[model samples]
Target: METPLTANIKPGRRPPDIKAYRKAGGYRALREAVLKMRPEEVTQTVKDANLKGRGGAGFDAGLKWSFVPMGEEASGPKYVAINADEMEPGTFKDRLLMEGDPHQLIEGAALAAYAIQADVAYIFLRREYHLSARLLRRAIAEAYDSGCLGQGILGSEYSLDMHLHISAGRYMSGEETGMLNAIEGRRANPRAKPPYPQVSGLWGNPTVVNNVETVCNLPHIVNNGADWFRNLSLTAEGGTKIYGASGRVRRPGTWELPMGTPLRELVEEHAGGMQQGYRLRGIIPGGASTEFLTPAHLDVKMDFVSVEAAGSRLGTGTIIVLDDHSCPVGMTLNLEQFFLRESCGWCTPCWGGLQYAVELLTGIEAGAGRMEDLDTLDSLAAMLAPGHTFCALAPGAAEPLGSALRYFREDFERHIRQQRCPWSS
Candidate 1:
């Protein structure tokens, strides 16, 4: 299952050697960019491609790189952190790239270091992803031994040093700034904006944090040029997306498809449709933290702008579809339980609101919900939105609950009205 850049990889198997990857033109981009292309040109290429962070925010990647200072101070010993803490609920897509093609990530990190004039790179692996950490460490040692990481790599003055840092295995560590905090060995809490990570990050150095997939796009962008990469978009936002599938499906796995591919195509054509007896009911579109999309939105193009226009986002591009006969309240309850358990306790909203959410959603699912309970849930989610919490955890928790209430209000009402689940036996 290969695309332009990853075309040589075998399906369901880990990628091949660093030498083979290089033979197939892997580190060529890093070498070329660091030695020939200007750092500004690298940022311009990314801008032309409209590459968004594959993390949840969908922030522009090129713009993020542009935020780095080009002064003499920024030219040496700067940093690039790979947010490999892939712990978002329903977001296991990064695990695939990490476990399968470790060198792709490493070379991409090297290329990013060149683009941003950074020498230090770190991959923040989650505690649970021990296997990914092991594999990446192996690949990093291999890169360094092969002279791709040490000083004067491939006979160029430009050098990139990669390091592996394991997370404490918390969900908050996935947020960009919180990840920065975690990487610094500080308590993982969201930092205040107006001084985003680019301005000041990772031990007070100019840092650029990118998702595993976002950085992995670099070699392709450099090798094929930005226009070729941008042309991969099925919508206005260019590049491919990796979609993760699970539950009530004939086959559930990650596949790289053109960005903005339709939901119906992903479900029906790619996922092999529903299981024997199930029918498509809705989709989470990104991760469980994202809002749900009803069957009416099956035609929505899977991109930042289109998913937003469809009243959701293309966060992480992992689509968790719900089939008919599944209880929506139960689905939300399971996710809320996760949010409650994974709260970093850095704020009241995520810490306390998640507890309340579990209780409220549990009462609804248990047929004990009061009429006012729905409003209570909505109000809580409202209070937890942007600027309320230190980071996006609380707000991300609210996305699904808010959308569930909006799109499935009647179902919620019926559960309360009948004091029983319609889908239950």
Candidate 2:
């Protein structure tokens, strides 16, 4: 109910063009924002709406924008970057938004750029998203032609330029500083913080980097007042979320549900529950990076605070279901291998520790693991925790592994004791 994000996205239909989009009240928010509202007013509206970033980190969007040095005293040529690189495993929500309603993203990005007084904007998209890239390019052209972008947008004094940059294809490239590096033709290694992208980014300018879904909420937040936007959610987070599900479920897909919708509703109602003959084991209530939750936690609200209170993040709001037929050790090993390969080698904890974790999990799955290996895996998880890494990649990698060990310790023992994976035929 009240799915503002996906109301226009009809299955099997091509995305609406500029004319069609306007006819359906698309850029009205941009028009109102540019012609009537001041840049600070736009930022204040979003802040009042309590819109949180949907790109894994649930940071407040307006609070983040408020960090930018504003007014005539602030520096010039500030930037806004849209993190369209939807590389998170089991997360395809951004791809759907970009391909389904490209103009919505453009309008949202323009609104965000306007709010921050940004002179330029960029969509740092993953290279694998060719279709999304094409759709966005066309949408950008349409916006420019319609005078929604470029010099003196809508004849206002504020001018903005936007570009689409295809990423160099690293999961780290989705990280704020890493995406900034990759956008500048450098290796996608994360930059050390303190002067975060807000104050200094993209050629050392004040750049605001936000996720696709996060920015897409801007147009709606502006079109409807902050109260309307906040009321759309079932919880305090404000607005709806594009919750997705994959693996073993009968209907594995994404849905635009009220924020804080229960995990049980997503799996049992929207995802059509597990396929026949498959009993629920656990669910990674976010992307691959989050911890696992057993069937008992199904009633937990799918919000940032609730999910985190349940001991996992509401990462990407995409649940990856694990069935009874699957092996937890094998699943963890597969996930660890992905994290190991995707690591940028920027830090030893991430690069070296993930490789060790993978090796241990591999041995356990291959029937060569010892009971002591579980202790070593636990050590690796602690070593890879948040403060030890240059970025979040290693910590994210540790979540599923650490939680698997916690929730499914018996399964790891079963593999070791039996000398083989029980689920493997």
Candidate 3:
């Protein structure tokens, strides 16, 4: 019931300005963090809070920050890059947070930058988010004018500068390494690991790239301490989650609920259940990249570990429902096409394997697929498994395809056997 993230957000109205935000207790955490807590202390508090990244990866936010080299003798000119590229399909939670409360993001970014001892921060946002860009620019100016950012923030020696960089727009650009490349004016192809971004990133300095929502939690985590943040969740993972539902659900929107809220509650209660006359067929329990879940798995908790245990991810905590009227094979084909087009072409498994999967899916949906193509599709999924790819794009693409085959084999068989889509009118 405590929606801390969205409590200050006023729907259908402009976001709070600096004065309004200040009166409402915004940036207090940033003040406390800069004036009192050491940089390492900030990071340790977040780690103790068990705040995991809201991004699909679900890695611990503080754990990721801990990897950055600290101390005066450590790397200089370190950076904190906020990944605001909300490119994942069926995932609009980040956009809502950014559009609804821009300063929260700015304050959070400053806190994150302070935590990592980084003087420079960049917000790598998608070009399509024109409104978010405009509002963030305004907020940044306000923060600077108010002494929250740049040259002795809040009268402390800890000065930080923030930059907003609009991306040209690519799904690959959302990946951390790929985001770094795009930010550097290089092609958005993913960089190889081992020289991981924590040690060497953005002009080859220690840079920490965190998702927008993940950074947004920093203010709350610092304001209330780790225990309060952890207690906000329904499960082991700390804090509330912005859960959303799309497709035939009567009320398709996002809500900030306790972490690990059940999937059934999200779809049936919050989403208003399936639209009249329709029944739930399946669900992609995150964004387009996550594995599909059948109706039987509705009781699964909507958290990282629980969802993973249920054989999907709490990806962006957004659910895309598949109604009885929709065709599973066709849906799979549609998803594959998006993945195929978005492939950065940096790795053959992603570019090459995704194209082949798309073609096979297209053929099957078009009534030309041979039964043997099923075997080939299975092989394609295996080929694009996690270790075979340069990044998560291909592997994430494989999730829905592989899971669709498992849960909707009958649908695929029907399409092939009927030599046409059964649901086609």
Stretches off by above 4 angstroms in model 2 are: none
Error of 3 at 170 (Å): 0.9
Instruction: Show pairs that collide, candidate 1.
Output: none
TM-score comparison, 1 vs 2, better candidate: 2
Name the 10 consecutive residues with the lowest summed lDDT in model 3: 1-10
| Candidate 3 lDDT, 1-425, residue by residue in tens | 78888977988999999999999899999999899999999999999999889888999999998989998789789999999999999899999999999999999999999999998999998999999999999999999999999999998889999999999988999998999889889888999897989999999999999988898888999999999989999899999998999999999999999999999999989999999999999999889999999999999999999999999998889999999999999999999999999999989988899999999999999999889999999999999889987789999999999999999999999989999999889
Against the unseen true structure, what C-alpha lDDT does each candidate score?
A: 0.84, 0.93, 0.93
Candidate 1 displacement at residue 15 in angstroms? 2.0
Q: Work out candidate 3's RMSD over C-alphas.
A: 0.7
Q: Could you give candidate 1's per-residue lDDT for residues 16-95 as a string of tens digits?
A: 67888888888888878877888899889989988888987889999989988886755445899998988777787888
* Model 2 Cα lDDT, one tens digit per residue, 83-141: 99999999999999999999999999999999999999999888999999999999999
Better of 1 and 3 by lDDT: 3
Full candidate order by TM-score, most accurate first:
3, 2, 1
